[model samples]
Target: MTATTAPAPSRLQRVAALAGAETRLLLRNRTAVVNSLLLPLFLVAFVPVAGLGGDGPLGPRLVVTAFAVTLVFLTYHNLVTTYVARREELVLQRMRSGELTPGEVLLGTAVPTLLVTLAQVVLVLAGTAVIGEWSAPTDVVLPLVALLGGMLLMTLLAAASTSFTRTAESAQITTLPLVVLASITSGIVVPLTAFPEQVAQVVRLTPIEPVVELARLGLAGQTWDGRSVDWAAAPQPLLVLAAWIAVAAAVAPRVFRWAPRR
Candidate 1:
């Protein structure tokens, strides 16, 4: 007798199942929980005290910096640890043996962290709107592109970083260079304008630079020189982000390891 073949799970079903499992795993890691969720809020609280640069009220700039910090800690840093831990545990290797494709495995693993980053950004924006008296973004599309593109790039970066991370504990060290560089250069705490012309020009080429520029342009509606912008101003930062994404996407597949390092 011929046996009937069960229909394969749809992409959504597959990703959702993987994401749900990842969520549960993420919840169990208290350090990751606090760092990814609570740490960003704590950092955002200091934006007013830190005094963001520019000609506008602090609300829009706060939103911009908050997005930067959130993507750094919540998405990039957390995923670095997650990838390392899963690799050390053979979780990635096992996932590859299943019905999941490589892209599915990576996206599923990142979904939990990405969702947390999104929630934290929303919370920060809400708090800023109420307390800082902020208004809606002048151009919503730029901010969305920044956040989504940042998440995708950060996820790819995390996976690529795992090539050097020997253990979950070492992820902290492996991730520090980018974390520190991005925090300082990505216009999170310091505006790119604070640097000299040549320095700022170099910083603009960094992976995180475009995300910050897009955030500022979208939320504050102003460029570094305090000039208001429209959709025309969006292309420069958008292209930078696209370039970074393409580089990361290309590098990740080449560097990403499905098995743990010896």
Candidate 2:
């Protein structure tokens, strides 16, 4: 009898194997553990003290704020550091020589971060439901869109950021500008309604703003001023998210470096 060659792994198996390895590496890094898991949870607890300080349902606003901040820390910030570290260590370049495609490599690296963010979001939402007495969302699709779109956008942005990020340590400094800006302008620290109308309009166009707005809209059935809006309004923020994702996706591949920056 002739021996047969082993079949290549399917795409799902390849991605899963990569993700499993990435998850183990993430757990081994204590700093990443604190930043990804502990810091976001701490921020959620701090939100009530900071206060939403405006009209509309407090529960949804609090929940959305938690969700947005979690995404920033777990998805965007973590991925930037991971990408930079992997590049500097030549892991990315070596992986490219294997059977995994570039997209598969990125998706695998991102899966752990995305899963962590999702878990934290669920915990925050559940806690808010019990403690804040929040109700079910009026429209689930918008918030779902917000979350899924935010993940894709943040992932692409993280990859794009690796273009300029010289070292893993520098990622902390480089990520701060966007993180601070998003916290302020994305209605996490303060509601968009707190800003003057002209300023809010311009701020709404910022990358993370649409995600926050959609979460607020879907969960509270209210806009910035706490006015009720219908399904027709969903398309606006959704389109904005798509636009940002498009821009980032286009730019990331063009600028991304497979090797560490010299």
Candidate 3:
């Protein structure tokens, strides 16, 4: 007789399976579904409520939608809820003991939400192309990277938050700080430009500010106002975003909980 061990699943296979299961779970949870979709939709709807910006909205609209979409689906609402839910249910602890590595566990969680976000980003871009005064980003690379970085940072922060979250129900309150900050100071709810120069500079220091700036810079001058975007202003924001990501990365492994807090 010979003993045999099963081969580990490839990262792609593991992630895909986890994502499929997670998607179904997300669909079943009415609360998660609404928070993921409706909350972001509310922000999208509020774009008009904010009134036309200095530009009719092509500019402000693009930035707001991009930031809000990422914030809602990627981090604040979706990931936090899922993390706490999984932890409370012992789903995360079970995954840890299985073939799914820790990285696979987290990646699997983010991918489904990432797919949802990808769809929204494309839809908004298409809308801009059709009705917007300017169609494309001034520099695609910076904005694309920044938005991606925002997703990664937000995802990391969501996992780190689970350290303090005792249950799925408490996630609603736990996620509020990031949600409120992004809504107020991160340039999603109101463009930093509307703030005074002093205030704008201070606001830019917020966690999500660089994320919004990336979208703003990328979408530059595509607004109804037809303002000109300065592409030269990419480095500082890149550094700011990178720094926040570094901090989150440092905090994540330390703060991440494998068992429910008693």
Clashes within 3 Å, all models in order:
0, 0, 0
Candidate 1 Cα outliers beyond 4 Å, as residue runs: 1-3, 34-37, 53-55
lDDT per residue as tens, model 2, 55-98: 56666766788668877877898899999999999999999899
* Candidates' RMSD to native: 1.8, 1.8, 3.4
Model 2's alpha-carbon lDDT is 0.83
Worst 10 residues of 2 by lDDT: 35-44
Greater-lDDT candidate between 1 and 3: 1
Model 2 clash count equals 0
- Lowest lDDT sum, 10 consecutive residues, model 3, at 221-230
Worst 10 residues of 1 by lDDT: 35-44
lDDT of each: 0.83, 0.83, 0.71
lDDT of 2 at 59: 69
Query: What's the alpha carbon RMSD for model 3?
Result: 3.4
**Model 2 pairs whose backbones collide:** none
TM-score of each: 0.93, 0.93, 0.84
